[model samples]
Target: MVRLIAFDLEGTLVKSVSGWVELHKKFGTWEKGKEYAEAFFSGEIDYATWARLDASLWKGHTKDEILEWVNSVEYMDGAQELIEFLKKNGFKIAILSSGLMCLAKRVSEELGVDYVYANELIFDKAGRITGEVNPVVDFQGKGAILRKLKDELKPELSVAVGDGYNDISMFKEADVAIAINPHEGVEGDHNVESLYEVKEIIEELTRGQ
Candidate 1:
């Protein structure tokens, strides 16, 4: 009955582990950059504030440089294979992420997923980072968008895969949730280390159905 499968774009789909951290490194925000994640997870800040903070880090960087950074990202091994497998198995695919839309859009288009919900970064006409962003999903709000997708796609069941604190909300809404190579204490119905294992998990879960 799992008809719709969703994937998180950062750690789960992109192999670099953290797209945000990559941004921080690229923008010279790593000095105090890691602190923002702690603030975000501790409820000290929301995604909007977090987005603004991120933008502040890249304010002087050019759009071309940012786009180059985004394009240089490497995807998770087996991501393309797993996506193709899901499609072949009759599941409509989705991407629910709090990550930047630039990379998510690229992955979704490459995989041809049915839907995607993610945030966007804004830039001024001069092509510089504006320190402003439009958020599509806040922390703990990923499920809200999934709920919206459910209403639109009308799937019988939903499956999700992720590997971060932000992804915890997705686990609650999915009929089947897999935490992929998670951080030390994150939880899910099942846990895995790779997208290859995810395919196996799904097959076993839906066997004989």
Candidate 2:
């Protein structure tokens, strides 16, 4: 019955706690960005404003520098293997993240995901960061997107997996929600210590009824 599996990026696909924080650290604004991140989470500022604030901190950075940071991201244990198994099993693999489009695109291609949804981090014609961002939606907006997908594709069974507070909304939208290396106290139908364990869950979910 399972036909779709959506994943979060920062902690789920990559080991980094926050892709935005990673970029901020690489570009020398991690500390300042933290305040904005807090505001974003508290609903004091919208995602577009938060994204632009992050971009503002990296104003002078170049595309190459950002890519260098993204390229250095380490994949979660068994992330590639899990992705392969999902594709092979005919699951519509989707990556839904509040992370930047640059990194999301790379992750989508690397994982061979069927759908990717992420916010755009803009760049100038000269390949320099533009200090602007095209916002998709808030972290909670992941649920909205997933709901839209369900309405359109109507997957017989849907699964959403993530590791942090932001994923709770999307998880609620899924028939089966999984938490991978979840933050303390986060709850889900399944709590897994590693991505490799997802294989077992998929097997159980997909086994013939």
Candidate 3:
């Protein structure tokens, strides 16, 4: 029996604009921007420089503008039904994301999930985005957070469902990891594309005594 059902936010549950894409669109894709940010996540660049570069990306945009962009995001089809069914089955649901907390919070509210954990976007006094989250959970750090949750909850069975490498971390601790492929170039163990199929998989996986 799966007692806990955890999910990834962006790319997994919804198709929101990615921070990298948004920043690149605004800042003209400075190779340094992508390279250094990648390096910082990979531990090549220190935290301070990463913060400075990230802040520069949204230097002019106000918080309201960012929220507007997020409001336009589209959800994975059948995402709502899947969450409701799981809840009816007595499973505790949580969203674990490597994306921005601002967007994750919106997804959580839309889906009515029990909890959400994601990197926060810092703001300046003028309410402009100051920088990306410090210690962001992009790759391996995602798995670390999952492991921590597993230890804390110790659910009878923990299942993770997601659509990207960031979701791969769920495998570190979850009893089962259902990978959904909603975008090209992303690979998963299950490779499901629809939320209805995901609901069926969960039902099948939990069937029988």
Candidate 4:
């Protein structure tokens, strides 16, 4: 009896491996961004500091410019079909990601998702990036958020689908954890090759419920 489904944005719903990395490449800041990422992974800087450092790299860019880059990101194959199937079956859809909010909001709106949670880049009064961010989702904070949502939504069962290590926390919180084309070493209750397979898995899970 799955009543809610949570998805990871980058690599899960979208074809991009990382919206942050893509933006860094687009803005010509990948080298620096890579350093920050390494620092975060090596236990040097914290997630907030890493995010701030990454956001600072895009300081002075217009919001429209960033939006344009976001729009360029393509959806994963069968993303639309899978989402439509979930909606048609009356499941609440949520996107919980540590990625940028611009892409999350875009995907949520286009797919008609019920809930979205992601980090947001702050901007100045002139609509330019201000090197600041509101870190709503941390790399390992997805479980806590999902726990809160479970209390609030009171769903009979909740499912989570993702493709990265950051999604493992989310997997722990879900009644059903699905890893779709997951990164190496990432595991879940089920492993799927694509979103089409994800739809099939869900269908079988809910077949008699």
Best by lDDT: 4
What is the alpha-carbon lDDT of model 3 when measured against the actual structure? 0.73
Sort the predicted structures by lDDT, highest score first: 4, 2, 1, 3
Worst 10 residues of 3 by lDDT: 131-140
Predict model 4's lDDT versus the native. 0.92
Worst 10 residues of 4 by lDDT: 1-10
72-185, model 3: which lDDT tens digit per residue?
788888989999999887688888876677788898888788878876777788888766455455455667777777777777777888877566667556777777773565
* lDDT by residue for model 4 (60-83), tens: 998999899888889999999999
TM-score of candidate 1 against the unseen true structure: 0.91
lDDT of each: 0.82, 0.86, 0.73, 0.92
Off by over 4 Å in 4: none
Say which prediction, candidate 1 or candidate 4, comes out ahead on TM-score: 4
Query: Model 1 lDDT vs. the true structure?
Result: 0.82
Model 3 lDDT, residue 183, Cα: 52
Off by over 4 Å in 1: none
Q: Model 3, stretches more than 4 Å misplaced?
A: 26-32, 37-43, 46-52, 182-189
Worst 10 residues of 1 by lDDT: 14-23
Each candidate structure's TM-score, on Cα atoms with residue i matched to residue i, is 0.91, 0.94, 0.83, 0.97
Q: Write the per-residue lDDT of candidate 1 for residues 1-209, one digit (tens) a residue.
A: 44888888888988766566788888779866778778877989977897778777778788788778778988888988988888878798888888788888888898898888888888889988788888887777888877777788887768889988778887888888899988878888999888999999988866776
Candidate 3 lDDT for residue 31: 66
